[model samples]
Target chain A: MTETESPTGSTLTIGVVKETKPGERRVALVPKLIERLTRRGLKVVVEPGAGAGAQLADDVFTEAGATTGDAWSADIVLTVVPPSIADIERLKPGTVLIGFLAPLTNTDEVAAMKKAGITAFAVESIPRISRAQGMDALSSQANVAGYRAVLLAAQRLPKFFPMLTTAAGTVPPAKALVLGVGVAGLQALATAKRLGAQATGYDVRPEVAEQVRSVGAQWLDLGIEAAGEGGYARELTEEERARQQQRLTEAIGGFDVVITTALVPGRKAPTLVTAEAVRGMKAGSVIVDMAGETGGNCELTDPGKDIVAHDVTICSPLNLPAEMPVHASELYARNLTELLELIVDTDGKLAIDFSDEVVAGACVAGRDEEVN
Target chain B: MTETESPTGSTLTIGVVKETKPGERRVALVPKLIERLTRRGLKVVVEPGAGAGAQLADDVFTEAGATTGDAWSADIVLTVVPPSIADIERLKPGTVLIGFLAPLTNTDEVAAMKKAGITAFAVESIPRISRAQGMDALSSQANVAGYRAVLLAAQRLPKFFPMLTTAAGTVPPAKALVLGVGVAGLQALATAKRLGAQATGYDVRPEVAEQVRSVGAQWLDLGIEAAGEGGYARELTEEERARQQQRLTEAIGGFDVVITTALVPGRKAPTLVTAEAVRGMKAGSVIVDMAGETGGNCELTDPGKDIVAHDVTICSPLNLPAEMPVHASELYARNLTELLELIVDTDGKLAIDFSDEVVAGACVAGRDEEVN
Candidate 1:
């Protein structure tokens, strides 16, 4: 066996494992990143068919200097979704696991990883500092989801998104309204504008108006300010919520397409498009709820299904990023690459530096004492 | 009784009938057009539920000055599709009928109309002259099909149509190519370009290169010219066809999306994307064949279905314009309005002037002698 294969070898081995989550098509790593890791004197091990969902074959990874072998015993393990309890039992002690570990929600899984002595770094837990921008997988995946949501809305709507002056007559451009101003909402507005739609954005936090305008979209302000800590809008009060819904119902009637992405972290998605709002909209209008997995932001939204209510089509597709596997995986793999560069030493050995805010913020388990 | 109810009255009455063809969602007129027709001093009657498919309610049509009643007994009948044998039997003798009668192919339907002594005007037979441009239903419907085709291709593509630069990385825009730079092809290229794709156009007729360039798309020339009369490319010779296919195979592989709209009147659509070319395309690429009803331009296309072949999605959607009923019906109604102006006198009486070129060309049956 090669010296790199030894359990206590100096050379670090990064293992790429296939995602086991149902309907999850993205991979933790891609073939192009294999060379980036290998150039750092790290040996890369990929499980068979690891990148199949992302359209990256095993032969492509092998051609990029990766070996097809058992990846579970490597020094560093990469994944897309949180590992199952059975998968946690398979990990060796002191293995550095990198992925979206869902540390805040998957309590049992976090406890199981601690029992297994796996040093878990949740990508979602990465501090949203300027330095950790490149390692933010949540933002990267949300960007893809936002772009795909507009295309889905366009496909279901019977009218054209862009204006065209033809021989018969002139067709007016469709009006698109986005109900959130985060990364996904901004990207959705930008994409809708690119397709020649008249795009508008709304958010509880009034500060995001400039960011929305920067993407060539007008901002709809309802005079509510709920800017919470950590870049998320706080839950609105009962009176404010009622007033917002009433204003939104009136505003939504003027739009041909409405994309709702409002979410309160660790809580159910806020209902921005009430059933009354849906009724107010035009017959051929469409609504794409990006927060479908979080119980949707529309009252009429049937999570994970396409349904028509009040003459409006509402598509609440779960895991929208998985539908576009190629680009989604590429961006996620890049995020992992940036994070790996921080935790791996120049000499190709595993080194955990808790002094760094990103490492300290992302680490949830595996220390002499509890780190969570 | 009203003057329009009298058989020998000077007043003229027009009837809008519901389309009976399966999958045809468009109507001959919309509620918005009722006022325009009423202003011409003509009585209008609409069959119940005629505009329902286009999202136009019966109350809306009634509010616009149209009466719901027996439309088949009106002096002139307006429809979107050719009347079936049973429908033709319902028409009054010497009644003026207007729509896409498919005179060139539906011989049985034309014979039935003639046996019933119905004066049939085929919208497809309208002369391609400046004065008749507003009455060209084929061009109007084709434009809708073209715009929808790009949307279909964009929806199926795994990558974004436009280039996106995010915090994680930069994604290049998709390259789209359209075959047959006719009205539909030009619209497809323009739509793709609007969606921020690198668009290209190719046609057998070299004269359309300027038209393609006007849509902000580069034209791909295979050095084959088949320009024919009536603004359609003539059938190519065997040698020319083989050479064009070979060159197209090489060029099509480089595009992320391909939309084919080539057709030769009554002939089957020419194969532009061969099976070999599909195999050469990258994974997750998409192809939309607009000529699915006439046999697709892609060799592997399954007409009226969306299928995956050689890692490429080939969508052969039939009656694409029907999918967007609102705009399709609106445009078609405008075309019929322009045609009605040619036949209806200012006195609000039936006065078919054979001297008019548009009237003479569009007339298919019911005369002292056969006009065909």
Candidate 2:
């Protein structure tokens, strides 16, 4: 495919940089997406070793028509995470920075972008509206975390996931309980079911019982509903929390594997399994705390460590999406491409409209000098 | 249930001991089988922590009518692996020993059993007849290994095992190859298929092509059959080996995950995947060398360690059954129970008929002092 497509000969230069976040292996874009952007009259430049973490070689990007250059010098710079302050200073004014910027919690990053005159689009801030569903990086990444959590649990569990009948005897299937019915929880439930486990899911929102059943998992009712805005679970009241805890403590003991994915945006994850509950679980049971990085939902979960408390193994895996970099980057890159298609015009110029809900929601900084 | 049940008032004592071999965590018996044996007029004794590795607590064993005692003092001492010399010293004359005694390979252990006057039954030496299938410990453990191999590969590979379609895009299913059609290889093929991988299996014996296809895997006919006696693959001639390697090197490059379980009795495992073949694999692909302890099927596999060669991760896990001790012990304990039932009469006394083929095949050391 040729790089020049527009008759006006107008094109934009886009840059892809290697992420510097510790243990973050995913890239914002891959070579396949670079080819797609370049074929549309967009000049693509990738920093050396930009795709190394995702097992993509530099030569492969070059082969796909991406040139090696200083990523900060391009008209638009793409990254998976927020860039370092030193890297951000290298970008000239009017440069657009696109990434999974945690705008709600990263007050300092939004201020720096505004002061530097860098228009930034936070992919995490993509609205939950149907129109912006294709560009939702948070949901896409969480899907990967959910799938990985099941694999991690299956590997750590002392028994087989599926039931099997041999000449010697028959083995019972493992019972898996997924806490929360978000994108990650749904995926975890589906993955566990696919592995032949008897998957059960719990969510405070009673409405999600159908979604849980749709994924072939039984719904766990704790008799307390905490449905909140934006499809997230609300913080529970003191009395509701005690009731939920009491019910879950008794139910958790029966499961061989437990995966907790209850994370409230910009806040500590709700405690699902307390230390006393861990003691109640069977000896060979395993718990995968998916929200470990944001202060786990399991009280005994030690973030980024595997602990055997009361004979139950608790694996608090952090950054699961990064661990499966190939698929994670592929999904992230596609999300970036869809978002770019929305904001970049046919002439390869910025076409941001303040009236557009997606633009207004995801735009953390712009020419208006708005910091938030 | 009472420990004594037979009208003759004779109850044989069967002991369960903790395996002393390094990295061996499986127990010959579990609490469930203890209840079964005790109900059948078999007095069960267990060493302290005998089933701890298998997640069967001491209280559970006692609840099943088993008493804590020196395992060596029982009428029959059961183990997963051969007992140590120090343990054998504690056994009185005429005590029966049972385990997966690799009699053909471990000449020293066989001699030790004969010299100590320990009548030993080798589970590995059990006849492959249909009637003796319940006593096949080797096949039971291999089944666990095969199932675990796919889980290990899915966890290590940087992609999803099954094909997935989401709002973002579609992920193709992982391609898996099983090099062997034995118990382990068949289980691996079945597991890979269960996980939604497109699986293919290869075997030197053409008769097993149907068995491979039955497990939902495509049969790979290498066009060179080396079917041997006793259900094992025969060693290939020099020229036959060259042709097989040539064809496999080309075929192996196409798979994302390769599980090799080709093992010849009393011999080193065949080299199915060479170093050159690993270089031909995709960067994020994985190879599980199931025969790691007996010299791996992959040339670069380091037994009990994971190595990355040519961007392909090679995992040579040893004793996968021990890693999932709960079911491993359950199957093993049942196998031991079935074997014991064959030798012990209803009166709980030894019934060694020289004409019986099952006993003749499995008896490694007996009153005749025959060691081998």
Candidate 3:
């Protein structure tokens, strides 16, 4: 955590708990993260071994000057991942718990958090924008996920990606296709290009062709736009899906490796590739679904598993962010630190102004409005 | 069929068959397609009941001056769909058959075409260039697919796409996300923008930001360009995938609807949306996977089916062009006609030029090294 100057005197209490879930090793708050809060007259606490996987120990927390007190004593409890029931019970009413709580998926846990009288903040819900850049835990993690997805595709592919001037016969470059053109898709495209795979991207938005071309791959157009309001995909009609498939069928069966990064916010993913389409591809093609944990983009894909169809391997990794925990954590820390700084007022204090759009948009727990 | 007067002396043969596949009533080739051949002095055969689904009748072929043949015979036999074995066997050795035979998925079947000594041409393989514009079957179908994709998404979504001054109150227009940014993707963007759906697009290629913005949607940059040679998406390194997912996860939960149209040529479609990502999406959100025929970009997608997951509906319909068969077929016919015109000699004679890249690329089946 970097130092933040405070013009006025104020104090904040921050708490940390050891990860309790099986195979869970990430500290809710990291060492540098704790340091950032403490330098600003904020109190920090640790329940021993919080940052063990990250190589920080109890002594490190103490050195940071975080108080080792009962979980309920802190004015604010900093958590890693979501806090478990046992951990939640330890907190007193009205304590603010900040973490990546599974608020949407785990409604029961949200209920528990509300019942315990805790004001909860979900880091995962932070939006991606210039103002919220510092608070985007997902961006940091996704950056890593995109890179990992490409590596996985390369590993699964039988041929090398780049053109090789080897002593043997000159090696032809591999052809790569990026399904989605989002952050992961862009990373996959860049990585594929860097690895020497001829990469092209397809999107329902034709405007991305130039970008795909800019990345050095011919943008294969299958002409299907489902753009709706707010820059999101609209529900497709029955006939339209069929048309897109026809165009896709013409283009889907020529690449050696494909990495997909397309996703709809707050909805089930649309099936871009069908089993029939899979059957059309040549044997030994590899596909990496970065969106696998939610299920997968591939019809034959199994979450957290790799399956083969028509001699092609479809990989769906669930916890891609966890795969590269170090850098992911570092980036996440930076984002969180930035977000926290925004709320810290002129005096060394935290403020949640419900009237502001930023605060109101993220305060989904409904405590302020009692909607939840 | 449009009249083709390019081939004055030389005659080419055309073949037609009644679509046998269920729901496959539209003939792959149409009258306008034959017009160019007729003008090229090509003789064509039509099987009874072809083109009935598209409201075209055998008399339409007869009226076009094409001989209705009991047995398939001709120097060049034009087909709308993949030739059946019986259809293949029906052809004499050294006959030319052209249509979207799907060489990528039907390689083995195509290999059989070679064994049967049938000269085959896959129109879908036409390169993207000004010279090949007339022959670009993909573009023709994609235009329709794009138009249809937008309409589909608009209809399925609960909210209206266009902003309206309605009695129900000034309704905020719907929000949509177009996952892939290809030709179809861009068209979708433009359509969505026109239809009043505020649309945004994501692509691995950074160059597409302008295109997205051009179509009235914001471009979210992921900071990594996976582009390699020719502006194609480069295969990403492992680290990149992680970062990409982290960013996308955050972006995915904010939109109302998503249309994913990501794919690779001759490969299994890459997975874009994860089941986890979908869980964060709101109920009533919709996803249309234009790449559904090639394998879906979504985790919960079942190609050729409609799926409801996490209270969201996912539609992956293959054969989109078939739905708008009239317009799609007409466009395809025009393109075929243009290519045929380009293939004619100054004296209106058929010129199977091996020197021409457009002819060479499109004429996949060769006779003695010459494209013809």
True contacts kept of each: 0.68, 0.71, 0.00
By lDDT, the better pick of 1 and 2 is 1
Note the DockQ of each predicted structure: 0.69, 0.74, 0.01
Model 2 off-target regions past 4 Å? A1-11, A370-372, B1-11, B370-372
TM-score of 1: 0.95
Tell me the deviation in Å of residue A277 in model 1: 1.2
Q: How well does candidate 2 score on lDDT at residue A70? A: 86
Among these predictions, the greatest DockQ belongs to: 2
lDDT per residue, candidate 3, A1-372, as tens digits?
Answer: 122232233376667776676555455565666767766667777776666554455776677566565645576676657777877788777676777776667677778777887777787665544566556665555655666677677655644455533111234677888887765676668667754578888777776677777757667677677666433457678788788767765577888787777676655666667787788886567888776755666777877789988767899887665554434554555655665665555454767655555545554463553433
lDDT of 2 by residue, A1-372 (tens): 112222344468888988888989888889888766876678888989888888999898899899988877788889898777777788888788999877877888788888898889999788888988888889989999999999999998989999988998899899999999899999999999988899999999999999999988999987899999999988999999999999999999999999999999888888999998999999989999998978999999999999999999999998899989998999899999988877776666666665778988888887375323
Looking at model 2, residue A327 earns an lDDT score of 89
Whole-model lDDT per candidate? 0.88, 0.87, 0.66
- Candidate 1 per-residue lDDT over residues B117-155, each given as its tens digit: 888999999899998999999999989899999988988
lDDT of 3 by residue, B253-305 (tens): 88767888776776777677788778888655678888887888887899989
By how many angstroms RMSD does model 3 differ from the true structure? 18.6
lDDT at A171, model 3? 40
Q: How far does residue A86 in candidate 3 sit from its true spot (Å)?
A: 51
Q: Which residues of candidate 1, in runs, are more than 4 Å off?
A: A1-11, A367-372, B1-11, B367-372
